[model samples]
Target chain A: MAEAAESPGDPVTASSRPLFAGLSDISISQDIPVEGEITIPMRSRIREFDSSTLNESVQNTVMRDLKAVGKKFMHVLYPRKSNTLLRDWDLWGPLILCVTLALMLQRGSVDSEKDGGPQFAEVFVIVWFGAVTITLNSKLLGGNISFFQSLCVLGYCILPLTVAMLVCRLVLLAEPGPINFMVRLFVVIVMFAWSIVASTAFLADSQPPNRKALAVYPVFLFYFVISWMILTFTP
Target chain B: MAAVDDLQFEEFGDVAASLAANPDATMVSIEDPGETPKHQPGPPRGSGREEDDELLGNDDSDKTELLAGQKKSSPFWTFEYYQTFFDVDTYQVFDRIKGSLLPIPGKNFVRLYVRSNPDLYGPFWICATLVFAIAISGNLSNFLIHLGQKTYHYVPEFRKVSIAATVIYAYAWLVPLALWGFLMWRNSKVMNIVSYSFLEIVCVYGYSLFIYIPTAILWIIPQKAVRWILVMIALGVSGSVLAMTFWPAVREDNRRVALATIVTIVLLHMLLSVGCLAYFFDAPEMDHLPTTTVAPNQTAKSS
Candidate 1:
């Protein structure tokens, strides 16, 4: 059966069309009635075709091919959705609360007056686990969590971090002073790297965490420079 | 309108096909018998030359008229600027929200961050966590100053310096925000939303400035009643905007992430503040600065 053809001036909605049609042919010709008719001479595309030879007749076969090719290209660009899961927050949230409570308890016992060592190692480990496990896994875990959910997952990680903090405190207690400061800095830097890794691997679908960090450092340096200048010049 | 230019689209398929071959094709539609029928073009029968000309003229005028109408609505002064700047995925989201419709992501919220666009959610989460971390740090510094003065020896100069440091830290936190906004603006790339990352930065910082700063400053108010009033207003405004944006697609892990970020920042800030205080107390005093002669018990504490 032959397809229906539109008359000289009828309008059609292209969006109503589907993704597959063997061949679509359209032409606009003005019937002058008395004088010779004028053919607008437009083009037609073969959206899909069972016969390869018919596809060659498409007005802009390359464009249609490119679009089809582009659509095909997009599918292969990212990882399969099933591998990355959305995590369960109910289990994760309370776990973090527990860890935070433990840390507060430990900090309560330590005297704030003395030079106690930093519990940086514990903080680092906690953050590492938190980022890797919950923050990273939520999407993979098959759940729709909010930004707050991300926070809760990280919070659970913080408990273990507090434990790490306790350990750092012990180390600081042994060594004391600027050495502890150095240790803390080292831990923060490590945690920062872990955050970057988590961002790239799991947060891959999300924004890049490290980009802001990079932007942040420069801004801080700029402020520091301005402040230092003011401090130096001011009477 | 129908009498005029109905003939123009008569060759839309052919034009689309031609354009498709050009490799710059934007959109195309296919007619499939397998799928349900939609907008089926009625049989084209009656019409004349003068009517055809009028239709063609109408289409031309209509195109120009549409463009003119669009230009009139294009000014950035409206709420659309906010929507364009803040809404991440769908402009339709902005329109719906603007229209005061409740936004609930019936089912799309189940997808993981990696599945949607790849790597987009990760950065946003990181940025959000970092923001929370900075806030906690400021809070921690405040707590330490309180603890140091209450529990141990109080040095006026040290207290002043701690205050100064806290102020600096608070301001420093805004840097990431500024950068975030700048990048979002520069990229003009929207991960899931219509607006880019820049919009997020603007939303975060704009809301922070309008919400957090005033709330923090109000704490200095002499009367609790007045302070609470200001706090309520700030919370209501900020909270509503956040809820409107967040609740539509709440992630289970987000709350945990936020908490962890808060705790880590608070603890780290505390450690730094105390460390700085300890350092200041122990360092030898120069002639220019006032010296506090340490008693034996105090000396032990300082050591």
Candidate 2:
């Protein structure tokens, strides 16, 4: 971004030399009042950073968003506590987990199709409604966390259990027996507990110690339900 | 920060005693603790704020209170009007929830904890938490019971959300409305009956249900004996709170009326738990070989 900002004129010159060159040297107007709101077009308003983001192709934008989503998922998988983790909140990670889980557990879609697992619509509704309920509980309990911030945290924390489900499917590929069942049980239990720890690590400081359980109980149930689903998956 | 004691918990104690003295500060003066037994049961914090103001002499707290006073004085339709309903501190909420959990006789739950400042924060939230708790646990128990059945299909029960919303909202809201109306009518007929404001009634009902938030989640246990036992324990604890709190309000009336009112409270309490248990949590259909085969899986986790 610093390079892009510094080399702003380079992009124009590389594409095609400006006819007069000085026309490109013109700066944005500073005479406009800076203190108040104005209805500037979005392109003009963000013209300064245009070279970095605006000139990117569709694939580049998607990749950037995906990279952000991947970083959050990685944080959940590793289960670290950092203030910067709380600063950025997005639903993309949760949405990806829901899709991934639904695809992995595709024994049957919700009576809709034969080939697909649980439909995306079903997973989407369950995840969002659970997240909304959990967020509402935290806010009502007088936690200082914002709604979507908690939602995104809870959503990303599902990463471990989703990963457990993936591992369970691979274990199921082996012959069904006592050994496989024990392996599945062990993986599901560990990841289920990990999911809880990751979520509360992110959310714990926001709630008071006494009332933290009230906010966290809903989070527990959210992952508990998914854990049960994973634990019960059959070959 | 603690100029005297190094103990950090002294702060919670200091704040707790001062908590009861806060809402009606003007009414409770130096001599007031000798008069009102209910508000002064704890060590007198009547002059604690004065000491703090003298030592810290921070106008920041005063400025915030002044801003709050301005907010309370505003008309009802503005944004602060609604926000102020949920403006209670975390300590006060915890104290109220504690009082609801441990219903000590001779001290009214509403009067000791709620009547002074009765906000809608607890009532609104406890109800919301119970809604999701039941919905999620209900679905989970269904899956867990059928865990090892090879042919059994898993479908997420989306309908439980709506059903939970309806049942929980109706009980939390409609019952309070009816009970408040009954109290109002009885107050007019009987001379000087203790009449609870509608919001206070709603707040008590709301906090009383906090036990069920944990209980509902535990209902995911597939064993019938454990589920019923949990329901009964939750019912007994929260039920005592409501019954004892309301006992004073109806003790003056005739025995039949009081008995009937108490019965209705107990009966409705039973109906909510048992009805929800029956409706949401299904009994195990069959205990077969597959379940036996996977029984060790459950045992393995426990071990």
Candidate 3:
């Protein structure tokens, strides 16, 4: 067990003694390697975010992670010219957006048969599958961005469309009409363009200049498809 | 006898000099004949292109040397084991996708690109993208048809997603399985035919479907003529890729079997596109019809 090794505190002291000069120094750790170590629990995290150390040592505090994820959502919403979006990219925001957007797009359960929208899983798959393909396309085009970083940008940029979906859901709550439909259309189209702009801005610097169009086209299609879902979803 | 000894010493010195110069390629050539892939990008240096194989053999090392290295061992069930299949670089994937998009006739895609490194990453995402492309386009076409009709309520035919997923994944995975099995059988029957690993065949099928992603999007055009043309172009590009890649694999078989194999590959490709066209996007041509959902002429015709 690492308990004994933890008590030693300083391995250098143990090795400095002349008696053990011929013997190898003693050190023991990594009994259980954990991803939690690399998470670094961003600067803005709460003071006791290390509460994860008190319980299961393998994970950071659930609250700290949620806070970090929330900050990322803020980055996506604001689209400030800051690297915070790229610096601490994570899939949690994307996953939440995809699920909520999928749920919002789903028709009421009152009548599944006649109610036409994509299946719950269909929206889920389309969002993720779209993000991944866009990422892969950029990667294939020799974009220098790391795979997950591209994914994080593409996924996070869905925040606008996610907001658009939420707005669409609220608007669909009203009775269907030409004026109402026009409102939803305007909202969805603007968000669709915003999604593309946000993603391309984050992705543009990394891509080779000549292939930027090839990379951005898929991002366009990806958001257009999701916005299509948002626009087409009827109450 | 003296001249013979001098000649032997000279050859050994030459070998030592080559080893000293470029140890990596010379080492590869020294042991494994199978290691020297014909398409290996760079020619081995320190030896002539023609004699690199024959001379670098190090056949003179008659003394037994103990080989002391692990055989790339990993446990079969771990993620590490399957990780090898997905190991690939970005440029390689880009080249393969380009090849699939515009298949050059007489070029065997498998031997040139895939056999060196058959990756599961491109294939997996390609199938996924195709699934969404078909499903979303199906929904979009349906929505376009009845955009502003009073009586028409847009219910997305949810089944399209499942159906597209089933048809596409089955084609990408199952057909490759069947084709790989058949190729294996043919390889045994006709010894000289080139054969590919199942992963490589799956890779070929997966990448070959990349054309359909754009074609499926183009299916949103409410005109049947445009849709068919798109499918035809996609099938034409992708089918030739499959056939050309597989022909070299099965060519040594009897003419009947070889021709049958190519015909089946192209026909199956045709069937998939046509079937998708008919099932998913088959709707009233909104382009010909007026903006409203009412088609009184069609209704009268039906009645």
lDDT-based ranking: 3, 2, 1
Candidate 3 off by > 4 Å: A1-70, A80-103, A119-157, A170-186, A193-225, B1-91, B112-115, B147-149, B283-303
Predicted candidate 2 versus true structure: per-residue lDDT over A1-235, tens digit per residue:
3233435454555456564453344222221232123336555667757757767898998898899888887788787768555898988788888788867765643544432224456566777887897787678656889888998898888889898999999999999877997999999999999999999999989986655765676788788767766776653
**A1-235 in candidate 1: lDDT tens per residue?**
1222334233443345542331232322223331222222211122233445554666567566555434322222232342222243333343444445334323343442232212334333434443444433333322234544454333432332333344455555565445665665465444334323333333334432322232232223222221211111100
Task: Name the runs in model 2 displaced over 4 angstroms.
Answer: A1-52, A79-83, A102-106, A109-122, A136-147, A175-181, A205-217, A233-235, B1-98, B117-165, B188-193, B210-236, B252-256, B280-303
Estimate, for each residue in B1-303, the C-alpha lDDT of model 3 and write its tens digit. 323323533554555444544445344334442243222222223322332223324432211110110112357776445545544544556778997997766877765456435777778767877987998887777666556555555565666777888999999999989998988887877874356778878999999999999999888876767877898899989999999988877777898989999999899989998999888887544443445645642442232
lDDT computed for candidate 1 = 0.33
Instruction: Write model 2 residue lDDT over B11-38, tens digit each, in one string.
Output: 3335534553365432222222223322
Best by DockQ: 3
Of candidates 3 and 1, the better by lDDT: 3
DockQ comparisons of all candidates to the true complex: 0.01, 0.09, 0.20
Q: Cα deviation of B99 in candidate 1 (Å)?
A: 31
For candidate 2, what is the DockQ-based docking class?
Answer: incorrect
What candidate 1 gets wrong by more than 4 Å, as runs, is A1-87, A109-152, A156-160, A206-235, B1-85, B88-303
Per-residue lDDT value at A1 in model 1? 10
